[model samples]
Target: MKCTEVNRLLNPYIDGELDLQNVLAVEAHLQECPRCNAAIAGIQTMRTAISRACEPAKAPLRLREAVQAQFAGTAAPRQATSLSLGVCLAAAPGIAALLIVGWLALAQPWNAQSNAGTAQGTRIVYHLAGGNHVKANLRTLKNHLDAEPNLQVVVVAHSDGINFLLQGAKDTEGQPYIGALRELRARGVEFRVCTNTLTRQQIDTRAVVPEAVLVPSGIAEISRLQKREGYTYLRL
Candidate 1:
């Protein structure tokens, strides 16, 4: 199978839900592809970290009682019935949809943890995926740098977030945003624009400002910074 096809099957493969044919295909692809193997490892690592971080806690007695009372008046089903094969098949799509949503929600790069006591000296990755908060996030980033001159900051921009990093982009005051970007760059802040976004949006790499570096994928870069480089994640 192709890498793209393998990618779509990864979660189900990991969950042991793939059919025998698909499972064999994905396994064959994985054996020859280091990138996909790395992706699987990353997913497993994030799952482990989230599991450890989100240990279940007992609900307070009052809250539990209140929840129970709210459901007390609900009538139980009159009969317990076994689901037919056709009904189960029909619900499979819905179950798959929920699985995809749940995986997306939980499979964040920031959920993974690096080794403890590594003393990485406060590295941070700021993620920007929308245009709405570009100016506000820039101000906040500047304030952070001003407050902590020693901070190691990296800004990863994708989607409409790449607007501020484009050539001749303007701020709310009609001033060139590149000037502010240059100032931040001078202050040791690294800006990364996603090439995937550029390709998808049909934008030339030359359109990106000199102050920003183009990365293959913004989300992948964020994941690398958080997992491999031990950078804290801040989404804005």
Candidate 2:
């Protein structure tokens, strides 16, 4: 092997990482090669000097004094090696940890109690399955609106319930119910009509209730509100 190639193996030999065969090959080159031998000796000397200089720290009197002062609530006298803001950030992981813990401690209860009762009030969903019992549910919804006045109500009309909300439809007085529904909506009661039933009955979107927004499916929409968004469901 050339001197350059022989010199390359000297450090790995000191560290003892090479295989026995490669070590013998390098040794064989080194025995006859004076130039490679001197290079290996120089490397060994440098390695010894580096290893000796890099030693474990011995705490000095000044270091002990600073540590004692910090524990005793006295100021740590600033030094040239005083922690930079970046070092403070890296060294003091507990500071950020404490802040996160504090934020969670303060935030949990307030957020947990948010759905207890709204200042404006709760939202009630009137689930109506139409046919003969439609009248009873309509009256129940009307009665609640008359009683509370402030509570927000949503009438999710699907199937046969759409007939009662049509223009000139009576609310037990031969008076048109559409105007009353519109007026209730103005007072914060919303009417959400099921578009799926409309399609089943061959009724156009323009046919029933101007205030109603057509949802894809009545059951799916009700389930979404009740499960996902925390709205209370009442079957009328």
Candidate 3:
């Protein structure tokens, strides 16, 4: 084994886990390589330090109670309880932080911690009724998202309004409406089409913007969002 290969096994070896073959290989290399010998010695020192610092066992809660009771017997009744409680509560914030870190570690799309100090999320809603010009309102929504930024906007299509995002939809100039919706969606604009309207009109959802999601009923979804999710609604 090379110096690097032997170094890789040093920690496990110092912890007494190296296999027979690996031990023989490591021994052969260490006899001749000063670098590997030093590496093994360094890892052995680290193992010794870690073993002395901590052992795999239960927490120190029992010891903590004893410490708290040391002053508890002399203090007044309320003071003793409060001091004991404070001693026990000392780990609360740290435990909460550890839980949050663990959750964020697994929840992140990438393996990373979620920053609590990041900007707050944005939530905005757009109401589209039957027969209104869709291209114009969609353009306005796009402009706001592009310029103001940080604004989370949802376009709710209901009733005849579902045509705004119907498959193969076009503007008065014959430009494909789905293209603009796609572009806006790439910038984070959410398109929600009312299922009630689609069922009534028998429109094919396959033709709508791929970003458009079907809600139970667009009007009801809009109302629920405004009342419950704290969304500010705008009608165009």
Q: Which candidate is the best by TM-score?
A: 1
Candidates in order have lDDT scores of: 0.71, 0.59, 0.62
lDDT of 2 by residue, 1-236 (tens): 77777677788987898889879989999889888888888988998898899987898664554334222211222222211123322443534343232223222213433362245665555565464344444555566667666667777777876666554467554566676576667878777778888899888777776767777767666655544444445544
Backbone clashes under 3 angstroms, per model: 0, 0, 1
lDDT ranking from best candidate downward:
1, 3, 2
Cα-based TM-score, every candidate: 0.51, 0.46, 0.47
Ranking by TM-score: 1, 3, 2
RMSD (CA, Å), each prediction: 21.7, 25.9, 22.6
How close to the true structure is residue 75 of candidate 2, measured as C-alpha lDDT? 23
lDDT of 3 by residue, 3-101 (tens): 778888887777689899998888888889998788777777887899999889864664454334222212222211101112212434433343332
- Flag the better candidate by lDDT, 2 or 3: 3
The alpha-carbon lDDT assigned to residue 8 of candidate 3 equals: 85
Model 3 vs. true fold: TM: 0.47
Question: What lDDT tens digits, residue by residue, belong to model 1 across residues 27-91?
Answer: 99998999999999999999999999999999866455433432332233333212112222243
Q: Which run of 10 residues does model 2 get worst, by summed lDDT?
A: 74-83
Instruction: State which candidate has the highest lDDT.
Output: 1
